[model samples]
Target: MNGDDELSLLSWMYGHDHDDPVPAPRLGQGYVELSGGPLDGSLLDVTSWTEDEIATGAVLMTVLGQTGPDGQARYAARPGDPGRWDWSGDAV
Candidate 1:
């Protein structure tokens, strides 16, 4: 494999330089509109969402921009460090 091929494989094996798909947002009951960040202009019609989905999303989004209980930013400064990735995908 070439250098690019090896890099692509490594990226896929880990989270680095990856873009995992978030669930496709859809309409349901109540609605939410994301006004900023990568989700800018995204709308959530929570009506169709399962309670578990909403709960999971709620907890995940809440910590993305907030300090932890100890007050450190959710992400680190040189966050590209492999150990810094939140593999569990839990923020709080």
Candidate 2:
């Protein structure tokens, strides 16, 4: 038939068809807000974070404007605050 019809057929065959035209979900959907640091008020995407990392209460992130030589910043997640991570200090 038409080109659009053919394309739709191919998409369905390849499992690329979607019932809704809404955009797909973005990467790092789940995020933690930085409380204190150079990245204060910034959101760190932790969607890919593992359970162990979350349980450890610590997340080391490398970001811009870091005065440290290594450019790594350390943060600690507080209890009852899953959406926020407090800056502890520089990692290196």
TM-score of each: 0.27, 0.55
Cα-based lDDT for every prediction: 0.34, 0.56
Q: Write the per-residue lDDT of candidate 2 for residues 15-63, one digit (tens) a residue.
A: 1134646333334366566667665655555677797786565545444
Which pairs of residues clash in candidate 1, taking residues 3 or more apart in a chain or in different chains?
A: 28-47, 28-48, 29-47
Residues 1-92, model 1: lDDT tens digits: 79843432333121112354633332233544333332333333456667555444432233244443322222211133322222232343
Candidate 2: regions farther than 4 A off: 1-28, 57-66
How high a TM-score does candidate 1 get?
0.27
User: How well does candidate 2 match the true structure in TM-score terms?
Assistant: 0.55
